[model samples]
Target: MAEYIMAEKNNRMIPEEDKIFALNARAKKMSEEVGRDKVINATIGSLLDDDGKLVMLLSVVKALKGLEPLDFAEYAPIGGTTDFKKAVKKAAFGKHRSSSFVEVVATPGGTGALRNIVANYSKIGDRVLTSDWFWGPYKTITGELYRELCLYPMFDENNRFNKKGFSEELNKLAADQESVLILLNTPSHNPTGYSLDGDDWNGISEAVKEASKKARITLFVDAAYIDFAGDEEEYRTFLPKLEDMPSNVLPVIGYSFSKTFTLYGMRCGAMIAMAPSEEIAAEFKLVNEFSARGTWSNSTRSGQVLVSKVYEDEDLLESVNKERAGYREMLIKRGKAFSNSVIEAGLPLVPFDSGFFSCIPLKDPAAVSKRLEEKGIFVVPLAKGIRVSVASISEEICRKLPGMIAEVIE
Candidate 1:
C-alpha cells in the first residue's frame, strides 16, 4: 500500500488566490460582453489633452541643451538631487518653515514613496484612515503591509465634504489614542471629482489639527493631482501653511510627476516629509534613505536631471500654465458632455468638480458593466459605482454613451 501525497515547499506552497487573475478575468468578461465597435472607452489615467504636452516639450528636445544624455544614465542618490528637491519643496510648500525638519526623497512615483513611507513608518497593526472614495492602490498597498483601513464617507448629494462624518471618525480614532494614520487626497477628489471649497477646506484642516491634539496621527497628503487641480493660485494658498505643520503631527506629502508633466512612463515621484523638529526630519531622512536603498536603490538620473531643469527655469512655468489651461478646457468640455448625456439618459451620477473620473450607480457593478459592454462601451466597475475617464474617451464615442446606457437600462 503506497501513500501518495503532494509535498509542500516552504514559501512555495502558498495559497494562490490571485486577485489580479480575478481582475483580469473580469476584464475579459467585459470585453466579450461589450462587442467590438461603439466602445466608449472611458478607462485609464493617462492624458486626453494634446495641448499641455508642450509644457515639457522644451525639456524633451533640449536634452542636448547642456549636459550629455549619458550623464543621466547613472544612478541618482537615494534621496534625489539637491536641486530637484529644492524645486519640489518650493513647488509644494512655497515658502514658510516652522518645521523642526523638512526634506524630500525622490521615489519612483507616488507609489514608490508611498511604499517606502508605509514600510518605514506604519507598523503591522496601525489603523490607517482615508476617504471611502480613494485610490484603490492605497488599500492594496496598506493591506499588503497588513495594515487596517478605516474609511470615512467622502461626500453627500450636494457634493460637498462630509465634515460631520469626517470629524466623528477622527474623534473615534482619537478616543482610542493609538497611532492613527490619515490619508487626504484633497484639492480635487478622484472618482467623485469634488474638491473642498470656501469654509469647508478650513474646517477640514482644522478638524485634522483637532485629531492631532488627541493622538499621534500621521497626516499623509496624497497630492498626486496638485498640478491638475483647478485655479492653481486658489489651491496653492494652503500649501505654504504646511510650513507651520506641527512636530507631534508629521505632514508627509506624496508628490508625483506623472500627470503634471505627462511623464507617466518616467516613473518619477518624491516624498516630502515635514516634521516639526529638524532633528526629527533628520531621522526621517536617514530612515527614508535606508528604505529607498533597500527598495529601488536610486531613481533614474535622467528624469531627476530633466525635472530639475524644468524647476530652475522659471520661463518653463509659462509653458506649463498655457498647457495646463488648455487641458483644463478639454476636461471641462468632456465632463459636461458626459454629464448632460447621463442626465438625458436618466442615469444617476456621482458629483464631481474636476479630476480624472466620474461615476454612475449600479447594483452588481461587474454584471451591469458587462451589459453596457454589449453596447460597445467600457467602464471601471467599483463596488459602489462605475468609473468613467473622460480623457481617453473620444467626442464621437462620448456622444453615444447616452444611447448605449439607455439600451442597458432597457
Candidate 2:
C-alpha cells in the first residue's frame, strides 16, 4: 500500500535547488529581458569580469588543454598522487612548520574533504560545531552523515571574533561528546567575508588545547577562499598557532583549487591531517584513502597532474600566480567599493573584511530578496541575511548595490 519505499534516513530528502542557484536562474531571466548591464546579478559565488563574463584563469585553461588524453583517462591514486600531496601542503602552509606531520588525501574538492572529515572524524548522532552564520552545505553534510551541526555566536558586541562564546561551546561539546569536530571557515569566509585575525587563532587554539583534556578535538579549517582574501603567506601565519595545540587535538585543513586556480569544474582539492605522531599520520593516510576508495574511488588524474605541474614548474607557477593576483585585486576593489558604499548609505552589514560575498542582516531575508529581484537586482537569501556576491559583480555595480539594498531594507 506504500506509494514508495525508502530508508528512514532518506525520508527527509527533498528535490530542491539551492537558494543561490534559484536566484541565479531568476537573474538570468531578468538579464535576458532587461539586458545584462541593467541587471545586477550577484547570485553566484564565482568571479566575474567588469564585462559580466565568467572569469576563467588562462593558466588553468592552458594547463588543462595541454594534458594528454591518457592523463584525462587514467585513474589517480585513491588518496591522490605523491606530487599533489606535496603541492597542496606547500600551497596551504607555505613556509610554516605546522605541517611537519601532515598527511594529505586527494579529494574531489574541499566539499569532498569536508565529507570525509564529517564521516570519519565525528561519531554518529554527535554534533559538529561552527559559527551560527555558516555555509549551508555544512549542515547538509552533517545531516547526511547522521550527525548534527551546532552553532556558536560568531561575533561579539564589538564585531570581533566571539572567543568567549567559542570557548563555552567547546566546553559544552567536550563534556558530552566523545569526539568534537570544529569547522572554522576563514581567510575569506563564505557569505559573511569575515577573516580571523592572528589573535583570534591563538585564542581558538588555546581553547581547543584546554578542551582536549576531556575529548578528542578536531579543528577543521576550510580555507576555500584563501587566495582571494589577502597576501597568501600573511593569511597562513595562523597555521603555526594551531601547531601548538595538544596532541589530543588534530588540525585538518581543507584546500580547494576551485577558487585559487579557477579550476572549479575540475574539482581538485585535498584534505590535510596534521597529526602529532607519525603513527597517527600514517593511520590517517590509510583511513582517508579507504574513505576515498569507498566513495569516488579516485579523483580526476588530469586535475591532479595539473596541480603538480603548476607547482613544480617555476614559469607556469609564475603565470598562475600572476593571473590569480589580477583577479584578487579585482575582488578587493569590488569589496572595498561595496563596503564604502554601504557605509555611505548607512547600511549595516556583518563586519566584512575580505571575501567574494558580504551579508546584510535582514528581518525577512526571503521577502527582501524578492523585493530586490523585482528591482532587477538578484542576491541569495540566507536564514538571517541577504548575501551579495561582490566577486561576481563589477565594482560599478558594487558601488550602486548598497544604496539599492538600503532602500529595500529600510
Q: Best by TM-score, which number?
A: 2
Residue 124, model 1, lDDT: 80
Stretches of candidate 2 above 4 Å error?
A: 1-15
Each candidate structure's TM-score, on Cα atoms with residue i matched to residue i, is 0.84, 0.97
Question: CA lDDT, every prediction?
Answer: 0.70, 0.88
* Pairs clashing within candidate 1: 33-374, 34-373, 34-374, 39-376, 100-276, 100-277, 100-278, 101-277, 101-278, 193-353
lDDT (tens digit, per residue) of candidate 2 on 1-410: 22345535442343356667787888898889889877988878889888877899998799889988988998888999999888998888877876448899999999999999998999889999999999988988898888888899999898889999999999899999988999999988997999999889878987898889999998999999998898988988888777787888888999999999888898899999888888878988898889889888898888899999899998998899888998899899999999899889997789898989998887899999999889998988888888999988989889999998899887
Question: How well is each residue in 166-234 modelled by candidate 1, as lDDT tens digits?
Answer: 888987887774667778876656666666675665766777778877787677778787767676667
In the predicted model 2, the residue pairs found to clash are none
Q: Could you tell me the C-alpha RMSD of candidate 1 in Å?
A: 5.0
What is candidate 2's CA lDDT for residue 4?
42
Best by lDDT: 2
